[model samples]
Target: MSEAAVDISTSSANEIAPGIPDPYSLPLDKIDVSQGELFRQDAHWKYFERLRKEDPVHFCAESENGPYWSVTKYRDIMHVDTHHQIFSSEGSITIRDQLEDFVLPMFIAMDPPKHDEQRKVVSPIVAPDNLAKMEGLIRERAGKILDGLPHNEEFNWVDRVSIELTTQMLATLFDFPFEDRRKLTRWSDVATADLNSGLVESEEARQAELLECAEYFIGLWNERVNSEPGSDLISMLAHGESTRNMDKMEYLGNLILLIVGGNDTTRNSISGGVLALNQNPGEYKKLLENPELIPNMVSEIIRWQTPLAHMRRTALEDTELGGKQIKKGDKVIMWYVSGNRDGEVIDRPDEFIIDRPRARQHMSFGYGIHRCVGNRLAEMQLRIIWEEILKRFKKVEVVGEPRRILSSFVKGYETLPVKVHPL
Candidate 1:
């Protein structure tokens, strides 16, 4: 470790820019800080305020995950995501289980022309027109799930609602067996959150688990390969215009990326939305009264909830960010949690405002060429779920404090207990 300590004393360190958050002082990634702390302290804003202020790209000496540069400001994170040449997500650049092989990661983890080519394959499928094609089905799926809720009973929102609906939707998209859908959720979580040797399981056991997940997807893929055409994401990926006879391992690798992409991230967003609305009852009422706002409200919820709190990016070449020196291969994590609540870019940066004019401007879905490919799909699921939720329940209130997961890679409630009563 360098004996040189960083000085975050500059005024700019306290704030990113006028009207936005103080990136310097926000405690965005101190996962040691509890979810209650996250909810109560606006620690994210403070951590980002400091990052944006004193060391926009300096290392976090105290992070147990090790010294990662917290890129708190919105523009800084954007720069890293878009400038794939300078920074890379191509391989182990992602902190999750070191990229065991370079064969095939997803467009999300790739760079340049290659990433763009793969992204184009399903871009049309998730486009507004294609999503509109699946809208009624998506809405109906949400309705069936919500309509079955015990009107007068209390339930954990993540388990009963978010997990069930998201896993089911992904099951529908991939044609995976619905009865075993929870397995998909688990595998996806393990793929991302197993972190770098954080799990107690033996390395062989973990690799076996990942292979087990890829096996199930293989079954699904084989079935799709032999079957007739259908209008779903699997079919799109399987029979894409640019795809050829890609190797099984490579195919499985990309499948893992898609599953991880399509599963846990959005699931957390769904769960986070519920927790946000329940905690801020006024915002909950805002949606209940004006259902039209569901579209805009989705943006607000994503901004406030800030699910998928941070993502790691490896610097490919030696570079200087916000005056801090970053050597080649150093791991840096962008704290979207802090960037989303940036005070300089937002009005009342600490409070949840469903009507925040720039709520859509948040970085939760990421930015640039490698921005989330499933963004539209995620929005579709969220909007449909909320619409049906509003129609059936007059009020959905939280019964207690929601608990966050232990892992920092994906930050969301483990359980969102709620009281769901009929309208």
Candidate 2:
């Protein structure tokens, strides 16, 4: 018998129709931040601020996704994130529960032993030593990308610079055919995109794109399986004892994980950094004056952007957290975006501080074992890009409001129009 498919009938309220409830009119406890519209319009900050102040571990009884406990405060989010044993990452890591028919078992959504083993297979690709070797190449590519940009004219920075640089890096990581690298970006987008987000016309189209992704990777796997192990992610999985036996579905799952893991976090930050610096002229001036601060500023940009808004974990057992009782199998969302901005934990969390003393102390890369493996690599790319930007351009001026991605999962810009004025 063929495997079951995703239930097209099941959907978030936002996907079902085309409206978000007025979060403002709802009672303080009634407001749900899971709605994609909140992030799309960039109206989530105030809601998170209210939750942090009044109800740190706020529960929304109903949402477009489902009932979920939103952990907004920094300390509380840390408690849940650190104690992964109690808050299991199994099944899914997004607010939306995985469909029974369509399950993708990536390590990030797996519990220990399995998660550790699979993650270890790919860890070396982004290990400190590997990152050190990559810096020169990253800087070279960044310089080329910056030089290639149109001068003194408006262009979508998201497409021209952000996506191009990161996609190039991703292609390199997978040892993918350089000519077809944009397919990697398309698959990454489709993997994170929602049906109502205009990325795909319907659920059917999204599944078709992902299936195509799976099919494409299967051919790569076949080629690698018979060859000597190389440095790319596919070879790592092909040779690693823990991952060598991954089924087509499992291989596809890990493929999506690496693609999005490699793509979105860095790509979004590339665009977010320019937008942040442009918004805060003083910070931009500080960066221009002292290029030495670019490394620290990279961390601040990651923290400030919080590329991924939240990561969900299901409760393994009944537990008390931040004065709220979480039942077994309950959906708990740790809002990294909110925690990064919690003033109690981060001084002036709302402000973009380029030279923040504890700049690296943020939950954007997450906490504990699941902390982003490519963090150093992401920082290196940002630092190199900014260094290249400073060398060639006086300013990457943001000329209009960024068109934010319609996603609470991937907090990012779809387009950021900017004009580069050369030094």
Candidate 3:
């Protein structure tokens, strides 16, 4: 749990490249990036940079989660992401494989026909037509949130705006009670948080909270089961032919996946946007002047922040990748955060440019069959928020350093102190 020392205030990439005299003197295999502290301290960038340059498919013989292969290069990660037949997502999608009896059977952790069938059930929720319908609602909420921010006073943007806005959307999607919307936020945190990260004290505590989430959702599921098919997520799952008879544990798993997936990416991106803008004032000026660039800017923000750092896949068979031999059942982690910053695939990868060409050519939404289903919905929310932000506020001043979350899986802010300036 030792945090790696790193200074992220400047825009410079780490200077430790291939064939250079090693300052740290640690061997390639000795460097492990899976420690949650690396991310909590914003220190993962240097290690990943070194890996992308020196050992794109580096292996760590030992870690908290045991041995795993690190895939840091862009094209190599894309190859693994697209070729699900070779690198499977069946057992788990985290560096730490799921516990024996606690395996969550979500589609992101599945392969093949079952994955396609299960994912199809909720696909229509974020389809183009549905997005069109959700736009006005999102705009109204964003406007209200922006209007409510305390002017010339520091506040936690992550809690007051990021979490609040996303939780409201999650409530609407689940058709859950509006009064209990914060419960959705709590459950989302519990679902993704590591035990020592302080969200929950132990695995028992985490599962207890999740089961409570399941119990609450079960009540909603019961109500929706007998009702006519509708657009809400619960109703869709209850009515979809393939999902109607989901086993209790499987149902719980899928619910958690949707809750966390729908909540994390967009919320973190919102907070990250504010932080990035304050850090790079010139880009903020460009955004303020040409609001139309917000769409492209949204993609860039997602890429730069890289909400989820990596997604793990188990090797289905022994295969050669990036000139490294991988054995069957080996854990292969695709570092999306690293790939997004890969200089080979992206121009000016380290700098945050709002108007970069091919802004969407990044790994934030992932690739292949397990690509985020709600990606468009997430982008729409960001675009709407920024549009509303431009119409009202001139700036969101980041008054202090952001407090980051402690898990490597969710790369995000826990608090970003800021004050809003009106236009």
> lDDT score, residue 361, model 3?
97
RMSD of 3: 3.9
Best by lDDT: 3
Candidate 2 stretches greater than 4 Å from native: 1-25
Per-model C-alpha RMSD: 7.4, 7.2, 3.9
For candidate 2, write residues 45-142 as lDDT tens digits: 76788889889898889888889999999999999988999999999888977777778889999999999999999999998888888889988999
Model 3 weakest lDDT span, ten residues long: 14-23
Off by over 4 Å in 1: 1-46, 61-66, 97-104, 194-200, 227-230, 241-243
C-alpha lDDT values of all predictions: 0.69, 0.88, 0.89
Residues 315-371 of candidate 3 have per-residue lDDT tens digits of 989999988999999999999999999999899898889999999998999999999
Q: Model 1 over residues 1-423: C-alpha lDDT tens digits?
A: 110112234425454332323433445443232122332223344444555665666565554445567777777887777777888877643444353443445666677777777778767767788778888888888888887778767788888888888888788777778799898887776665543434426656656777887787777767776777566666767777554355666666677777777777777888877777766778777777788888888888787767677777888899887767889978877778778766777777667667778578888888777678888888878888888988788888777766666555566666877888887
| Candidate 3 accuracy as TM-score | 0.95
Which order, best to worst by lDDT?
3, 2, 1
Candidate 3, residue 245: how far the Cα is off, in Å: 0.8
Error of 1 at 390 (Å): 1.3
Which pairs of residues collide in model 3? none
